[model samples]
Target: RREWSFTLPAIVHAGTLWLMTLLVASELDWQIALGIIGETGLGRGSWNEIAWGLVPAAMLAAVGAWRTWPVTSHAQAYRGLAGSGLAVYLVLWVVLVNLVSSGDPWPLPYLPLLNPLDVAIGLVLLVLARDLLAYRELRPAVPHLWPIAGAVLFLWLNAILARSLHHYAGLPLDLPAMVQSTLAQATFSIAWTVTGLVLMVAASRLRQRLLWMVAAGLLVVVVVKLFLIDLSGRDTLERIVSFVGVGLLLLLAGYLSPMPPAEDKPTGEDAA
Candidate 1:
């Protein structure tokens, strides 16, 4: 726990330092600063880039330093740091988005709703951390698999409902010319839907490494399509490709990875 005490303080300190840097940087070139703020509308850039990027990446080098000494379980420390970090980051994001939106020429579209995924993931982590800290006794009987199952079910239900609703409403949900090809549309819709399911499930499980890899690959594909492809304002195909590819990769990885040991039950704390 002592390690977490330190780690949380460090992240807070780093975030504060980064925020200060950005405030100073914003003064240098207001246009560029506004551009940075606007980029989030296209689903990129945030305080994470402005502040955290400036910190030495090695700040995490000593994350597990106390593992050997075992003053407190490494898991405990990690949970503490993660929870605190999430809170700090969320507040910073809201504040920065508000600040930038106030002075910009164009309105920041739904700044409050910016980065739904980040909000969702942070909430999940916060819940997990709380469970790890306060409910150690209840972990054994809790079904850790519920997260994966629930996510899958949620995605499946939502996709089905969306399709049904669109059909019943007789809405013209057709893709643009560039993405309207039979194969392209089908490939994208199916692939993305599957990928979303995979991501939801993975997020529920708290698989950090897998989540990061999936997110990175998807981001790369999405960026290429959005910026590089000249689809004439009709770039739905790119998003479909990103979602489908990332989801497929996540599913493959999940299948190949070893399952948790059957007899090694989760502690009560894990369930919370």
Candidate 2:
């Protein structure tokens, strides 16, 4: 069942967190270790921090496991606990950011605590939120493709307009700066365009024909930017061709593929 699947991942995540804690302790002194942990803002620094952070995490894991128990169905409890864990994590992130940014020394040597792990945690929370949202039947009826499409258009247009205005004013844009700006713009444009194309393909009601339109428009704009760049003839064209080619491939894939169906409902049949 889907709920069981969710539960397993949650358990794995909690275990991973505990394992990470052990590793941290082994690598650092107690004062530094406690500082790093407290700086994470999952809980306040005191006897209560461990009680709050680890206890809730453990409880959520237990609830998830219970969802799989044959005698007792704890799906609702699992959902509530998981949602609470996510909220706690988000609040901690905000508090930690503000605390760190205010020029306070972390209890540790300011270890890079915020990394891919945070992203992984955020993603897991998003998954939990999606499930809870769906359970309440509050899922969006309309696909979210257009908003992404609009963002892509806005960024692309703004970049082009800025470049044009700079040129008209005869402002001396340095070569390195120009390349950096162009690359950044191209990166965001390609990313959003790909997302839009994917959403268009996946949503049944979305017009597949429009995928090509968006692709073509993006291609034209990128091509124009490349041409306007002051690079040597062959190198400029090659760079342009390479990026455009990849973008086109992604667009083609999105246009041709259909969206996957929503996940199946979890059956409460698995035993813990």
Candidate 3:
């Protein structure tokens, strides 16, 4: 225990791992900025650069994943080592943004949010969240929050998709455009409602009061947004459909999912 408690070996290991990770990440950033693999197309030199950059990243991630496993009692020390490596791997997206561009019209159909880079980053977050955040003995509150994070990410994607569609359709930024966009944006509202309903059902199945409350919170947000924002276009067909659709979904949710029971607190003797 003494050896594991921020001792010299642990400190040295953490520092070394972080330093190596930073170095590799910096190299990858340079490669991306130089457009080793970009719109121009791939070449042997590009492949070499990509291979060099990704190989190090993969190695670091492997080391982090291996160290993160609770195979021993020194979970805290091990987590530090794991985080040093994994943190860089997770944040590589941020480091590689703003790559030099030709400044020509955007060739991609989707916005930056839906680009391959962003998609890859989202996937990485989902893949790493369970390992990095879910350990009941180490951190109880964390496991409950992944759902919220996922919900936020899902909502963001839906919104960006709606925006991209509006752009692709060449909708002008005006009142009529707003009316036209009501249907497109209503899709996001529907998605939000569905996400809440799913969460509610999951909460009921898992019998988790916290999760049920989270689901309720999401539903409340949808309701507020519907009344405050969506109501502006009350005369629009999209708004009518939204109201009817959401109401029906809520009714179905009420029938299918009930609130989870609160967890019983330990009595004084039991706690002792």
Candidate 4:
């Protein structure tokens, strides 16, 4: 068992991040920023300001995690700290901002914009999350959190890039918004399906059921998003094409991502 230590530096790290979040997040106007995304597009929106505050915050957390990963005596504590800090940082941008903006004043439900910098920051956090999971020193609390953080970041990156495509295509505004957005959904689904396959393979290698479960969960999210959000108001033929294409994609994923084999029990145990 590892000893838990209460050190000044550890307290400092936690305290500093918490204080920063509270202070900076207080002044940030979520409604206005999302309005920018809805109007000026993802590339020009107020995300630049949010990114200035949050991207660095996420970077700082990931750096702290990497630095403390190798310390023996403090490894466990640092692992917890790293995962906690990372989850908190990523959630601020990924979930919190989106949830807040989607309702209340702005009432825009589409995803918030992510600048190039935010995507880059998300990449860092995704790598850090994997590293945290790789370390057994991480507490049980970790497996539940860091993987979610990584998934959220992954989705955020895809949504951000997808928004650009939706914009560049310049589809007519007269069409139902959902129907117009199907192109983005189909494109994004391809990536999501591919990512899900990779996750299933990773889960197989690590023999972690949770990883496979999350991968399956992601595929489900894509299916639901396509049907409920993107396919609404579309013509019959377009809907048919999407359903057929996505069905084939699911079949491919199922073929490529075999579940781990069941282990044989000892004879006596099996008999018992």
Q: What is candidate 2's lDDT per residue for 175-200, written digit by digit as tens?
A: 35445454444444455455455545
Could you tell me every candidate's TM-score relative to the true structure? Answer: 0.24, 0.33, 0.62, 0.54
Assess the local accuracy of residue 203 in candidate 1 as a C-alpha lDDT between 0 and 100.
52
Q: Is candidate 3 or candidate 4 better by TM-score?
A: 3
- lDDT leaderboard ranking: 3, 4, 2, 1
lDDT of 4 by residue, 1-272 (tens): 22334577765655565566565555454543555554555444435445444544554444444643343334434444534565555556555443222111112333334443344455555555555555555657685676576767685656454454544565432225424566655666666777787888887888766778889998899898777865773556655666777788789778877776665668986788
Which candidate number maximizes TM-score? 3
- Whole-model alpha-carbon lDDT for candidate 3: 0.58
Model 1, span 105-127: residue lDDT tens: 22333222133322433343344
Query: What is candidate 4's local distance difference test score?
Result: 0.57
Q: Give stretches of model 1 more than 4 Å off.
A: 2-188, 196-272
* Model 3, span 1-272: residue lDDT tens: 11124777566666665566668767775675456546474332223333333444454445545743341444444455545355455445323321211111223444545554445445555555544444444356566656655655664455344444445655443344544467655766787788889989998999977877877887888888788778876458888888888888889888888998888899999999
Q: Model 3: runs farther than 4 Å from truth? A: 1-12, 33-60, 65-85, 88-115, 133-181, 263-272
- In order of TM-score, best first, we have 3, 4, 2, 1
Clashing pairs in 3: none
Scored against the true structure, residue 76 in model 3 reaches a CA lDDT of 43
What lDDT score is found at residue 168 in candidate 4? 58
Among residues 3 or more apart in sequence or in different chains, the pairs in candidate 1 whose N, CA or C atoms overlap within 3 Å are: 136-269, 138-268, 139-267, 139-268, 139-269, 140-267, 140-268
Checking candidate 4 for backbone clashes, the offending pairs are: none
Off by over 4 Å in 2: 1-61, 64-115, 126-180, 204-272
Q: Where does model 4 exceed 4 Å of error? A: 1-44, 50-87, 97-115, 123-141, 170-180, 204-210, 217-232, 235-241, 263-272
